[model samples]
Target: MTQTLTGSATVDEVMAALAALEDPKARAINESHGDDHGVNLGKLRAVAKQLKTQQELSRELWKTGDTAARLVALLICRPKAFESAELDAMLREARVPKVHDWFVNYVVRKSPHAEELRRGWFADPDPVVASAGWALTSERVTKNPEGLDLPGLLDTIEAEMKDAPDRLQWAMNNCLAQIGITHHELRARAIGIGERLEVLKDYPTPPNCTSPFAPIWITEIVRRQQEA
Candidate 1:
């Protein structure tokens, strides 16, 4: 699957390539997370590498509505080239967790309209879409916190995070963790809020991997930063 494809590839050809790369084990794991794609990312990236950035081909593959093909399209598509409306349409249409996450992380985050979309989607009634908005907010929380209302964010999390849908809860938890890890003044209150809400507190985490529980995640990341 890592073999480089020569010449311009067609949508049918790329879809077939993706189908050929499917693995049952990977598909099972992805299915557990609400994604249907079985093609490993390495193989997908290899295919995208050969195809290069083909925006038209990416659009065609996306139209096919196949998970693997959509992922390849995401890889080969130019992130910043999309118009804001097009990105909004794609975000709403991309309901699959992996595809939604990729579109937000790989494409929308790089778009000139990231802030615009973030603002528009934050309070969108659709929790999944709102999750993408929160995801974007988390990025800004980590990288650029100057103008953001840190306490206001905490107030919202305190009110809404406990019963948020799975995806939205995860995104909100990430934002909470980031605030606690980044701001000394808010760390104790953030941890307290997390303790009260208990979102992801019981999630099963593998050995040595950080838990999604904000208190633990924030504390652990802060500890590591201190050591570094």
Candidate 2:
């Protein structure tokens, strides 16, 4: 039988369950799956509102520095529950980078007010948040290239490439590939990036894997670019 998580469980209760896991990475992965199961907008909205009343709990969780707790915080702050300004405030107050990334990936990406949220990151001194903006913008572009601020995205990508994290770079490449697939005019750009990616000295190669998502995603981008 499949296990079911109860809505009545306090966030702390759920988090305790996550913390008991021996593997930190596995705990992070599992908490990120909060969106799975029967989780939907209504349930998430209720949880988010509940979090607003528990500021002390939220602060303690943030200070815990545990990846699983951070992930749970992000899960609780659903995009639909809070306005863009509110979410931005929450992200700013969040001390954990992984939690911030999760919010950027899941919450910010789903906001109808994404453009406004994107603007707030322009003066962010942190490379992680700045790169996250670029990554999120790239995702938006893939959905609707015409709506993107292309020059701004290009500048962000160029600036970020210098010292971006491996995961962020992977996300960048995936976003670029997706945009290339959706927008015929970006074919050349995608192919050039793909070629460079293939030759990168430390390009990720999953163990015992022949066709990882990264290379495959880039190849599709290159092929589509050629076709276009």
Candidate 3:
């Protein structure tokens, strides 16, 4: 039986608990995606639930720099508590995909400095960092696109997505899909751009799961929305 984690548990105890939860298959899958954690996400969240919110413990776990520990830290972290510089440092330190992604989706988005960070990271040369920027941009495209340069975003996606690293390419593709799905005025152009680029067109999607091929993705999502 697994032991229950608690907020008062020291970082060492949490580390030991994480080690005990490691699964060989999970490690292999994460390794394939440039992540090195062995804990199943469900179990990791269960551990986090037991720990609840412990800012200082989160800091200690993050300090260890273990992918699993960092994931747990992210789960328990107070998004607004981190200074912009500290968040920037964490983003840089979060080189692995899972850690980088969760940090962006879970913490960075809620920070007071999200827009500033997004603007800076958007143009960063590092694909990994740029991907985070794209993630933030996509959110804005869907929720609040008042000042965004939509045309420019499409222009850059058209010019750069084909040669981008896998993660960055995926992020750009998501932003493209968001634009097409949300903006009726730009829907045709977004679909055109997606069809021409053919990015992820051949991606193998399981049955009933929507394809990431942008044209199909945009169309399918719009269709669902209309039906609802």
Most accurate candidate by TM-score: 3
Candidate ordering by lDDT (highest first)? 3, 1, 2
Q: Give the TM-score of candidate 1.
A: 0.96
lDDT of 2 by residue, 1-228 (tens): 122235455656655455343454544554564322222334334444444534335445545555555555555544555577776666665444556667787677777877777756644665555556666666667665666666455454445543566545655555555655566566556545555545243556687543334335556556656799
Model 2 clashing residue pairs (backbone): none
lDDT tens digits, residue span 60-103, model 1: 99999888888888988988888999999989989998899899
User: What lDDT does each candidate get?
Assistant: 0.90, 0.55, 0.94
Instruction: Mark the 10 consecutive residues where model 1 has the least summed lDDT.
Output: 1-10
Candidate maximizing lDDT: 3
Q: Output the lDDT of residue 105, model 1.
A: 88
Residue 179 Cα positional deviation in candidate 3, in Å, after optimal superposition? 0.6
lDDT of 1: 0.90
C-alpha TM-score for every candidate: 0.96, 0.61, 0.97
Ranking by TM-score: 3, 1, 2
- Tens digit of lDDT per residue, candidate 3, span 78-139? 99999999999999899988899899999999999999999999989988899999999999
What's the distance in Å from true for residue 151, model 1? 0.7
For model 3, state the Cα shift of residue 206 in Å: 0.6
